[model samples]
Target: MPSTLHETLIEMFRERPALAAEVLTGPFGVSVPTFDQALASSSDLSAVMSTEYRADAVITFLSQGEPVHAVIVEVQLGPIEKKRRSWPAYVANLHSRLGCPVQLLIVCPGASIARQCAEPIVVSEPGLSLTALVLGPDAVPVVTDSVTARRNPELTILSALAHARTKRHRAPVLEAFLAGLDIFDQEHAELYADVVLAALPKAARAHLEVLMTTTPHRYQSDFARRYFAQGEARGEARAVLAVLEARGIDISEEARERIADCADIDQLDVWIRRAATVTKADELFA
Candidate 1:
């Protein structure tokens, strides 16, 4: 549904406006806070610093109380527009409107382009870094919070990307990938399960027939995929505990039992927290 990169980025940002700041300052690279403290901003989202209207969907980021400008983001979905005419004015007006220094970022779906300096220094001023984002199937979707990928449309996007990576073939069509995964072969089965997990809507997958046929073998296969790949199985109990332990969580036998029985992911998350820290050797879980 989100055909263009600009549309996709904008939609994702709106899903987590706070992420705009995180992505801006992250490895996507402009200068950003770590993913852990991604949304702990100092700026008042309700505050309107400058009325310098220049373009549509070109957004800016401001640190909460910090004077330094956080970031400048432009969602370019299509060919350059006449709005390029007003970019200089937009930059200058933004500086005068907001006290923080601004950095320029051009976020595109497929490719990015940047200009070192703006000719109308009065408007754009100086020291604007141009950058781009070309997110494609081969690209891994930025992962920060679980919900970032857990949500619906985004879940679909992540599944597409992961499947694209595993299959030596060209990026598979979304529907085609689903059909391929429906077969449930042995070798690629675990990998396909990841795609299914990634593809399942936060609301839940309605078409889980191939995945949820529930025969002894199919159930075992599904359970194996969840347990091994996600460290949710008997084979993974200790390992899952280690990851949770890093965050100071501890696991118990009862917790392990609870997780093993949980086919629903939401419930599994609860047990994952408990076992995350209580286990010993990574190899045991490994």
Candidate 2:
């Protein structure tokens, strides 16, 4: 889920801080100088991840072309206090190892009685502290503009979640909700989903067939059935095969047989999309 959202959010934070904040046009919308002065920036925080023992999608804050802070931002969809120990330790580790002023930022989906973070969270030693940015259920307002709506189509889904009552109507949230199956880390996934879904509208993602399926990608067997059965995508299967072959993906007879044996239309649909990028067709085998 972090893969779907976070890195892109650094831009939303930069280009449109208001969207990152809950308010439409208030103090939250004010752009930070950090974005303006950055000669350039990147989400390649892999180096920091190992150093800090933390998540990868951290949004780095730069000033005067120097890395001032690397925020180990955690999106806590569950219990924020539950993660207090791990998060602060991660920040402490980053600071000691990397000698950079690392900060921990905790973001909850919405306000909760369980969210007891009233101060800068500290851990391991008194020297390390992490800030909390918690949003309530109604925070991170929905899109109201035609241009923003067109640009960030993913917002439609987040907006829908605001009013959704049945699980069936939450397809948009479910499409990116890989954490429900724990396929990805749940807290990380929730945070990632928040940033990306808020930044883009669901319509912008219409081209991606994975979103249309009822069977979540975490359910490997269901992908083909859920997606392919009702899918309007053209030559999807052939496209999958062609892409795999052209990419020089190593395909075995057994693997091909397995794909053919697959009855789940949704799984096939996901496989077809993945085939378009696979370096080895063997990856498709169960």
Candidate 3:
């Protein structure tokens, strides 16, 4: 089952199919034929010869109504031995279906997992092997410039999430993310913000909170207003847990659910203070 982060990463690529091509040609330095349009292709790669196979996303690049290149985007959070076998099959099926060159792009947030994913996979035949093209932390560019972030907001979100925890890049990445939000409407922007917020640590999240609050009133988007108005309690709720998380405290699902369901800022604040010295998560309510 796909986690929220996994699904969101795939959605980012699907939201802007061209972004996958850009990442490939720009960062991955893989040649992709120039195309007039990019569209989502059926991820169902199942054929009569094989069982059902579904890729996370399949983007087809077309020129003059004919297929030029296709990309399979996969977001892998951890190493899965089974993927090594299934991924090669995914490429083979997609290639046969599209009758075009297919690139397997695996997006891994962890460098270690990326390294593992990049390892060559040998099929049933002794000689045949396939290596995944991985996009990991080191591969993701630090998107600190507002102009660049706004121009490629989806990419910027990936960059922000990739580097949100890095000490040097945290502040700038969050700032760029805020600027990038300008390109989206309230609903979309809010959703993106929530994702970034979920990735940040205590100090970095606080910095983002400051940046969002300090923005000029005239420059604030509807999303910005909604964030301050409705998101404060939820953000605080997360903060209390984030503090405990940073302290390496163990939390039960019941306690986690309690904090998550809370909407009172004052109560969350008390929990936040209590979270700092608590040996266990349940102590927050004690």
The candidate that wins on TM-score is 3
lDDT of 3 by residue, 55-132 (tens): 899999999999999999989997668778788889998888879998899998888998899888877587888888
| Model 2 Cα lDDT, one tens digit per residue, 129-243 | 6655433334434443334433443333344334232344344344333222233233433454444445434543342234434455443223224334533333455556667
Model 3 misplaced stretches (Cα beyond 4 Å): 124-127, 215-226, 230-286
Considering TM-score, which of the candidate structures 1 and 2 is the better prediction for this target? 2
Candidate 1 lDDT for residue 3: 42
lDDT of each: 0.42, 0.45, 0.84
Per-candidate TM-scores read 0.37, 0.41, 0.76
lDDT value, residue 21 of candidate 3: 90
Where does the lowest 10-residue lDDT sum fall in candidate 1? Answer: 38-47
Q: Which stretches of model 2 miss by more than 4 angstroms?
A: 1-31, 36-52, 92-103, 110-130, 151-286
Residue range with the least summed lDDT across 10 consecutive positions in model 3: 217-226
Weakest lDDT window of 10 consecutive positions for candidate 2: 18-27
- Choose the strongest candidate by lDDT: 3
Model 1 C-alpha lDDT versus the unseen true structure: 0.42
Report the lDDT tens digits of candidate 1 across residue range 39-101. Answer: 222222222464445333434443453334434445554555444544545555556656655
Sort the candidates on lDDT, descending order. 3, 2, 1
